[model samples]
Target chain A: MSDTFNFFEYYTHISQEDILLSYKGPLTDVLLSEFSRDIRAKLQEDRRTGKKVFAIFMEMAQNVLYYSKEINHFGNNDKVGTLVILNTETHYKIVTGNLVFKSSIPLLIEKCEIVNSLDRDALREYKRKLRSAPSEHESKGAGIGLVQAALTSDNPLEVKIKELQGDYAFFVLGVSVEK
Target chain B: MENLEIQGESGVYFIPTVKLRADTGVCEISGESYLEDTSEFYNAITNWLEQYIREIKKPLTFNFRLTYFNTSSSRSILDVLRVLKKFQEQGGKLTVNWYYPEDDESIAEEAEDYMKDTGLAINMFSFEPEE
Candidate 1:
């Protein structure tokens, strides 16, 4: 076949990966609620893993909704991002990607490193410290979403940063829970 | 002062049910909370607690029955716990109890972390997960 876009090829790739859900574009509250309902229903058979998967998904999705560099002005000015869920033999992986300011890469990397280095107790302690710290006006959230995600998944977070044109870069975060 | 009571809803966002009684000095926050305006919602509850502690000064029982709460809501919960800790420090009589699903250990662990963070004792109880 010629070097062209093939719909079946894309479909086959997705099927092979066992992608349960995938979404691109704006991340809004409405979308999150709907996705959460669907996920709860889809994973009803395994409530414990289902809860962990949902928790990690919410934390990561909210991270994108709040911090993505790209914003869609369709109505509520929601942030644009990508979210995908993959079911592997051993784990359920929730991955999210969004554009962020290039300057934030270092801090983001440090945060991820800190989260991945700690054990469960230590992660909880770290989350406590961050939560109790004096709140900055600009950042109302405790900035401990990643820490929470790590604790819930009981797996080290996987992070990848790609340099993009201008002042933005793509940030991808993956969290996995044992199935 | 008038009591504060907000009915929880699970529509676009999960709003935790809240009730702060002025007469009995019994306050409850139950249900799931994952709101976009997390801070705003918790701030009012925090303020109400402060007011109750200042004026009522009765023996207070704080009940937490949250099934799920996001990180932002966790921060707000800590804020509320801190207010209670302060009240206890000032010689105000108070008891804090937290309930979670028996299947979910994270919620119990979360309460433990809160206890460690605020230096306040929290009584943890686990119940059957709702059907």
Candidate 2:
């Protein structure tokens, strides 16, 4: 096979997914700002739903920015990932995929379960506990981000993990906010 | 100690406005906070606060009017609250007021949650018409 890649297949994939906004690369600051503005503009039809959609979009994008294992050109440990937003008739769905270190998978799985299982009040309590708990690492999130996503979402998080290579896996999470 | 004033940047990353005045001893951080380097940006504010707590021993009033802050920035926000709580516990006069839109129940709830974590009574001021 050759080193050259195909772009036509990728376009079809995106079209099939009904992607509104799609980005595949390092989650840089510039990309975030532009995408958020466009997303806000696109979601302006309903203010209430728009707020939830925007919030969820930001949360998911940040997750990819914080956790993805893909490195950048400058040798900085920059998290790289893919983000896609889909606007359907009944809801707004955000899908994010990133490379994850094997060791963190258990914690990530547990967190998803914790958020998915809680009601609004209970999730609020969970968020409080997370904030008060001694933060494990400087690079780690407080876990409240996912809780925030859950609060804005109408459905539980749909998370899938696929083995990629040694000590790395592709982690995908889907968050849906109803319109 | 001198005052520190930072203009909130709405572009690139949602930067919050920060003003710490020695003359009035009022520190306010308003607007959204979503910085590229979260810790680096917040440490500057905390360092200033630490110096103020050490040298300029005076009553401090903190006003937080943030509409949005990412999780990373939220950690820094928690750090600030914890510092204030400690200052109060050590007999330092401290007042924290959080102003948010009345309709934004989420922000109010977050402030309440902050109150719980810090064990400090945070005064919440609301604006905007409620639905």
lDDT of each: 0.90, 0.82
Give the 10-residue window scoring lowest on summed lDDT in candidate 1 chain A. Answer: A134-143
- The count of backbone overlaps in candidate 1 is 0
Least accurate 10 contiguous residues by lDDT in model 2 chain A: A133-142
Model 1 Cα lDDT, one tens digit per residue, B16-118: 9999998889999999999978889999999999998888899999999998999889889998999999999999998999999998999999888888888
Model 2 C-alpha lDDT per residue in residues B20-104, reported as the tens digit of each score:
9988999999888988888898888888888888888699999998877876787789889888887788788999999987656
Q: Residue by residue across A72-164, what tens digits does model 2's lDDT show?
A: 776555668989888787777889999998888999999899899988889888877776676767445647778888876757899999987
Question: Would candidate 2 be rated incorrect, acceptable, medium or high by CAPRI criteria?
Answer: medium
| Model 1 vs. true fold: TM | 0.94
Off by over 4 Å in 2: A1-18, A71-79, A101-103, A165-167, B129-131
Off by over 4 Å in 1: A1-3, A15-17, A136-142
Interface Cα RMSD per model, in Å? 1.0, 1.7
Tens-digit per-residue lDDT, A1-179, candidate 1: 67898999988887775787899999889999999988888888999999889888988898888889899988888899999999889989999999989998998899899899999888888888888887655554525889889999999989999998999999999998998
* Lowest summed lDDT window (length 10), candidate 1 chain B: B122-131
TM-score of each: 0.94, 0.85
